[model samples]
Target: MKRYLFLLVVGLLFFNFGNSQAYYFPERNSNWATKVEASNSFNQIALEEAVRFAKDNEYSGSRDLRIAILKGFEREPFHKILGPTKKRGGPAGMILKNGYLVTSWGDTKRVDMTFSVTKSFLSTMAGLAEDQGLIKDIDDRVGDYIWDGTFDGEHNSKITWEHLLQQNSAWSGELWGGKDWADRPPREGGVHDWKFERPKEPGTVMEYNDVRVNVLAYSLTHVWRKPMPIVLKEHIMDKIGASTTWRWHGYNHAWTEIDGIKMKSVTGGGHSGAGLFISAEDMARFGMLFLNDGKWKEDQLISKEWIQKAIKPSKPNVNYGYMWWLNKKGNRHWEGLSENIYYAAGFGGNFIVIDQENDLVVVTRWLEPNKIAEFMGLVNDAID
Candidate 1:
């Protein structure tokens, strides 16, 4: 009996030890820890090659982002820089392995515009609202909460939180002087035809429209009853030990009254201009929070369930999730990379790739947008 009891206790001890995590978390306002010898986990030559590849293939756009925005989107009708834009720095990025800095290049601390990577952050806001029960169900009609004319129409009323997050709400209309149909209009159609066309049923198709994205931001603002920036700062950024330099912005005319006080609604991308302006390091930290399944050290800032839902493939687009881009086999899938990989991508080549299986978080800025797949392939090659 004594011998049998000893074996049982020993087995239990081994099981508990095996389940314990062995990752690191950087403290607030301090330098992140780095791998003492990166060679131990990564092939030094391959890793160096990845960094060099990123630096060599810088985005070929005007560093003055205002010019870049206007010129880049010139194909779209009535596209204009409607919000604030900043001159961007050269290529900068960081790679974290098991929460330790593995390698970095360029000015990791330089704050720059992150463009549509803001969408992932905005999606987190919805996750927070759901976690707090502010949104009882994502499937619940958004009109049920806002009640404002923003969601009054038959088509618009069908938009649920999930549909908005998935970019498939097909919520037609205009906001902040931008018409929904004018954004990335059909390549073949004229303005009149595009405007008069019927919008697809919510959840049936995915359309990447800035006006629809802003509608989501506006609705979320009403749901949170305060500035979305404040909610992000208080709930996620501060808790994750992000820097004070990061800022979220909306269009110049994007103000609305909330609780008797006027507040500016934030945008999900920098397509027309302002979204998230942040440093590469801060972005990596945010990536790390998701890398560990929404847990930061001892605190679970966002629930694991929400994180799971955020990364799952949506029906309309296998390559998209709740604002996060999945690497599932699809149009945007990176060849030779794990299908489980997910990332947040923005214009001007900003990306935050989360490879949970390998315990990696890679944040790159100003890389050539098309070069990401090749760069990630090289990065993945480094992990021996």
Candidate 2:
């Protein structure tokens, strides 16, 4: 009886430990546990079909073409973290160049929180605003755009619009991370008391910062005389003929799951990231817009010159553009793009790669952390 009780106790302890080891975030849902059993969920199958369609049209694979595709997906640390959740509620729909349905990969369900990818969307809208003379050039100062005293700090007031776009605003990024200013709500605090760490002179360096983009978001509203979401819907989404079923989760950053499990928005960008939920097909259309110089079916959504200037390499650094990443060698032999393929990437494997020179736009959405290198190798080999 003693031995039997001991074994029973051990089993119970093991079960308890196992339960303790269960990995879960505060916002994980049962839907995430529900995997997509169909092979049609992944965009790869669709991409293969798209490739075959292009091949039928006498378009042979070139090293340059593949390189552009691979470079777009590869070189990002965030893309690797999207594979495991592939079966979970992720990206819906797929669109490709070369004119084909690609493969079936679920419906055009507007259920995806494309993180920083929204930044690219916002950036494009800002560019359009500039073209329409609503705002001035990228070189305009923040004060010039949002005169409501948002940028009225000693150092921050001097920050320019280009500085925010370039990620070189020199403002302390920690301020927005809910660090010392947790009690202070963002964008509502006193501008005079805002403390910023000026590492280097603005416009001379590049540092990825979300607060700067939030500032950009605020600036867009100030200039457009409309809410940011309304601005986007009116200017970009409607202009691009995107589905109106989408909703921007402005606050609370909760995921709209089938069940009651409210998932908090991870990655980055509230509206910049968690706000804009879109279908992969619409994302592909967005990519194609950039691919075709911001023109959709001969209707110019944005000016051709604006598109050219946005993707073109920035001065002093060829690795980044306006709200986009460029394929440029950093230090090692990492040759990403032969001609700097511009890509708009989002967290959780959301990618809309536009290789203009190669006439390619590849879109992918998955959930696997730490599988980026493996997928990147596949991408490189396939592209090569």
Candidate 3:
């Protein structure tokens, strides 16, 4: 009888521990829990001060953020910088610990172009395609499905989905009226000399070129057999319970036809214009979903294996993953944050930082770029 009672007690302890480990997802109504209820490990005052500090730093962005990027980067013609854009909010963010809102700042409802953070969403779509067998092998030459001249030519044909995902595809091309050299020209060279520089082998050099990223976007469109936004709405955004206010816009001139149907090819960044315009709440949901290893209430939205590979930094750039930014080597960027942390960062100071170990998801928009580290450090210090 004593042995049996001891085993029964052990079983009860394990059951309670498992129950404590489960997450408490927040609903859409106003009943979301407070910081105290959401987290027992973090100091509430520290969290509040962190948010207050972030809110106080809201005005650090260029007074006019709409064309601030243009003022910073003079590569593209001002007229060509077109598509969809929005004036940013002050500082905005949603903090989640164990899937509950710990704190939030600014206007979570404001929808603005998230810039290159769109690359992470684009990568998610590619992941969804791979998960559903739409993409047989990431190593397969992209030229196989995309018969268009986009992936043709000797060097270009050697490029694969992995190469593009890693930003090393060196697939030479001008798409959406943006040339490779013109996208991100050298900082210290004459335009004439930069444009004439010889191209390198595919998968050799890692260049953050939107033209190449757009080509990858266009290639995925053919494989999925539909517009990417539609695919995302059906498969990801809708599943995560995102709001209807979000949008993913492509350039008006970037239309491509497949199977007698024509659609606009999306971009991986809001460079010239148009990218992901989503609410902070929605982006928080995205980070939370990823924090749970691509699962949403037992539904494996994406494979765990793919996510593992997605977060794993590429060979050339340990600081970058499929489309995510990793803090590899512990000092790649975030000083006080853990090396295990990764994020989706964008221009105009947008971020979706995920720290699975702490069960934290932080979404910030329109904050000062330089102050992000300090803000994140403050948040981390709050945790017990």
- Cα RMSDs, all models: 3.8, 20.8, 3.1
Q: Which model scores highest in lDDT?
A: 1
What TM-score fits each model? 0.94, 0.63, 0.92
Off by over 4 Å in 2: 1-95, 104-110, 172-199, 252-268, 271-273, 315-317, 331-337, 367-384
The candidates, ranked best first by lDDT, are 1, 3, 2
**What TM-score should be assigned to candidate 1?**
0.94
User: Scored by Cα lDDT, where does model 2 land?
Assistant: 0.52
Q: Model 1 over residues 1-384: C-alpha lDDT tens digits?
A: 999999999887556432324567888889888756333678889999999999999999999999999998887888998899999999999998778888899999999999999999999999999999999998999999989798898788888999999999999888999999999888897889998999999998888888888998999999999999999999999999999999999999899998899999999999899899999999999999998889998899999999999999999999999999999999999998999999999999999999978878999999999999999999999987
The model with the greater TM-score, 1 or 2, is: 1
Error of 3 at 73 (Å): 2.2
Q: Of the candidates shown, which would achieve the greatest TM-score relative to the real structure? A: 1
> On residues 1-384, what C-alpha lDDT tens digit does candidate 3 reach at each position?
999999999888556433434565555433456544456667988988899888877745564555776765665532366677677767889888778777787889888888899999999998998899989888888898788688878888899899999898877867877888787776787878767887777777678888888988888998998988998899988887788889998987888988898888888888678878888888988887899889877778988888898999887788888989997873357886798899998887889999987878899987877788898999999986
Q: Identify the superior model by TM-score, candidate 2 or candidate 3.
A: 3
Q: Kindly report which residue stretches of model 3 are placed more than 4 angstroms away from their true locations once superposed.
A: 1-21, 28-31, 34-37, 77-79
Candidate 1 global CA lDDT score: 0.92
Q: After superposition, how far is residue 380 of candidate 3 from its true place, in Å?
A: 0.7
After TM-score superposition, the amount by which residue 69's alpha carbon in candidate 3 deviates from its true location, in angstroms, is 3.1
Q: How many backbone clashes does candidate 3 have?
A: 0
lDDT for residue 74 in candidate 2, whole number 0-100: 47
Each model's lDDT:
0.92, 0.52, 0.82
